[model samples]
Target chain A: MSDTILFDYWRSSASYRVRIVLNLKRIAYRAVPTDLLTRQQKAPDYVARNPQGLVPMLHIDGQDLTQSLAIIDYLDATRPEPRLIPADPVARAATLARAMVIIADIHPVNNLRMLHYLKNEMGQDQAAVDAWYRHWIAEGFAALELMAPENGLFGCDAPDLTDVCLVPQVANARRFELDMAPYPRLTRIDAALQAIPAFAAAHPERVKPA
Target chain B: MSDTILFDYWRSSASYRVRIVLNLKRIAYRAVPTDLLTRQQKAPDYVARNPQGLVPMLHIDGQDLTQSLAIIDYLDATRPEPRLIPADPVARAATLARAMVIIADIHPVNNLRMLHYLKNEMGQDQAAVDAWYRHWIAEGFAALELMAPENGLFGCDAPDLTDVCLVPQVANARRFELDMAPYPRLTRIDAALQAIPAFAAAHPERVKPA
Candidate 1:
């Protein structure tokens, strides 16, 4: 009860994004793992608590919040320092557009559930499934490489919501073995994000249960 | 430009959502159709302007913007009246979560590009593609029915971002002929949205090219 509890999976890109935000904001949160591999997200109790049956649901201030970006927004709203969304309207819109390139476009298409469907329901082989994953990441990153802030951050001045989304999707790209050579800017931003203490702490390898 | 120009397609659920928001806010915008069927979004000029090659891109206040929700956020931030995001932190979180259920979960899976990939790349038949479309909408709506606000709106006492996302998704549901009996609340809320002038004015049929 003392710490904000995050119901998350270690390898979930969406969960990873929220975890980075929590660490960035210095908000102490208990990590309660929801094992997607085991289909634990579908359990009656879990489904009742979060109807979306998605990981990265947060319980804080006696309220339940779901959706990684929404949770990040809530954290930013409640804890205004280290602002995740930019102050300028144009910059904010640009940052969000960049973030959505990952959140709504890339990650959703290449997520574990979609990959599973591609393999099982669609009868795609490992190679085909892997191709599907890399294709999306590559397509998304192609655009993001152009749109990312030129100041070496994904957003202006500092790592904003776009950076939070970028690193996780980059991790997914590496996991799927997509060629990173094409997206130099995204790779540079991801490298920068990895150096940040908050992002380093939230790495899936660090959060993965032994 | 005499008015803000929205690069859009009549049948695009994303553009429809933004159109509803513009109407709700009483903002006048000129709709410049981007023919997705002809792959106009991928042409060199269009891709140069919007690297993502997605529609509902807005040219406003001497700035070019992409992504529907991001554009809506930009509108809300600049206009500040009849806010799309709620004032209360918790309420805003809830609203955004519901919106993501559509934006991230449902819409992305059913978008035209995904359907094209399923058919052309994966050799999915019309029936298979239809089943895929219906599967995602049903799964998402099952949860949204529970998470949606009880006052017959998707957010505090009125339609907020969640409703903006919902109505268009429901329009998609109808277009795909998904059974509506399962989500009574969503149907009721959609019915409410249809009565509002803003939502009605943005219907695909009205905006379709003659």
Candidate 2:
């Protein structure tokens, strides 16, 4: 078995966050795509490993770890090189807060499953669903645009947890065709992150299966 | 000014998470209530301290910190007493994963703002809105029931981050009148957590304004 295996889907925001961290730290891991479109993630075998039946389950250190941020925390703890979070406690907290504005506040509400629920169960049409999707990203991005520091290309000169979260979410915003005009700073950061080989490698398009 | 101040609201699941952690750690700090109903959190002065206009912004160590989990991370890093997270990296990751199941997946979907949006924007009736609220909790609690461990009093021997998050969510579930019959393990854990003085004191009702 490889030292690490990431069960992922190309389009999952959570999965993308971990991929960015892994690439940024140069950790070698084999990717095993759990295609979300086909409900492969809901398979009995996959659920046995992660009770949540969620994608981006990382098998490492002889254990199966779920939750993207938690997996990133493990990687940062084990591989301290090119630290994903800042060394200063306050900065670390702020970075994490910035990350959660996406992870907790924005991403989950606009999750594929959520959109599906809105459509299938709640009888929301595509236009309504799309509006709901953009509404959240806009709400979150508005705050993040103001909160993000001008210290570096992203939140800081060096990519931290915030950028790991930002790039994937911005990708999703584009997928939904949410206007990027309101978030110039976020757009600039995304552009900067795209130039980095690590962030570039983790892009959904790069990981998508042919 | 006191070294520490917590801008909080009684019913916010995010704020409740931080209050539970503070009480559990016996950290002394003044609570400055920010009334969400009054939109006090969105006030210019409050927004200056926390751009997100969210409650449970902790002002400590000569800085203002947002996000409940981020604030808790700062506390766990600085205080390190009766540690809220496990010492081991893998264990910490699992605890955080369990916590995020509530933080990211469950809580945000059922937040007050979302409910308001459902009513005002979507024209959802009270019945429909309540159903929406309960639906997310049931979905999350079902998974959490299996993810939680068979350990002592709390999720583990001592209530860790998982329990801090779990108890508040269960409280919200109860308030929403969500059917709890399906999640026996979570119910048991919440009951056990309630006996802890810290958890008891942090209950929403206990913190309600006179």
Candidate 3:
């Protein structure tokens, strides 16, 4: 069995991002589905491995790595093929900035835990939670739409970190029924990325347990 | 006047992270205060430069950069001295993972805009908003405290990305009156980090506009 083990939830956008990177790099790993809906991720055994008790914790290279972007950074650094992040400093910064719009700005606000807090702790209804999710997605996508290139993938040619992050977020956007008309560029990019075998294989539907 | 211009808001944890990096690198740049309180970040002129409409946008090397981590990555790549992110792959991943606990998980949820949404849109009261803020900080710090070193700076000798990210977050925690007693390791590290000139000069109170 491959030493790399990814503890991830099927529907998590963060986990989806890591799965895309792992597929792109052709990294083999055992998948341990830690169902977020069931709070399996917060189990003592899992929390011992990941103090954050968050999914997408990758046990690889003898280190337990948490955080999707950090894991991708490690993969890119170690594998160094089909480079997800650019080598040029300017290009790297620009690419990462785009990724952070989703990673830091949008996804966190819309994360399941945050949504749960809104509902359980703050007494928000389903409609309120759904609106909350859509609000952040639309806000981040508006900026991303402006930032998207007029042509080619986000990385230009093969997909890069920006594309890796963009695809999962787009999936979440669609799940939330966000209006895609305002983000034609991002929609085009997501379509192109989805066609890539690496991204296609990482789709949560493909990995979901029957 | 330096060609590099940093458009940032005082008291912004994300912006404070960038300020620490710039000071550590001894990079001279003009500070253009973009007030968040008045929603100055959404101004069209600023949005034209940074489509994300976020502060901590660094106009450096003739390129406009947004996102605090991405801006720091750019600075680290160019400056190279007092390197914030480690060169070793495993070390880099570990450092980044620590930083992301606060950056992606905590700060994003407790950000000004998110708090505004809870209070204004979700109709949560000030007490609810404060609880929301503290809950995330305590959760993130709990994880980080476990990951913190028993002694020395986060980088052993000098501050790295994790340390850079931590100082600003600790400041925010104090602002929200989070009881730091539980996170002794993180609290110790924050104390050491605060003594550093770079971190001290970047404090929100120090940099606040008259």
Which of the numbered candidates is closest to the native, going by highest lDDT? 3
Ten contiguous residues with the weakest lDDT in model 2 chain A: A148-157
| CAPRI grade, predicted model 3 | high
Q: lDDT: which is higher, 2 or 3?
A: 3
Runs of candidate 2 with Cα error greater than 4 angstroms are none
Give me the candidate number with maximum TM-score.
3
Q: Write the per-residue lDDT of candidate 3 for residues A9-98, one digit (tens) a residue.
A: 889999999999999999999999988888998899888888899989999989999999999999999998979999899999999999
**Predicted chain A of candidate 1: TM-score:** 0.97
**Compared with the true structure, what per-residue lDDT tens digits does model 3 show for residues B113-199?**
899898899999999999999999999999888888899878888888999999999889999899999999888889999998999
Off by over 4 Å in 3: none
- The residue ranges of model 1 lying beyond 4 angstroms of the native Cα positions read none
TM-score of chain A in every predicted structure: 0.97, 0.96, 0.98
Ranking by DockQ: 3, 1, 2
Question: Of models 2 and 3, which has the larger DockQ?
Answer: 3
Instruction: Provide C-alpha RMSD values for all models, in order.
Output: 1.4, 1.4, 1.0
Name the docking class for model 1. high
Docking class of 2: high
lDDT of 1 at A156: 55
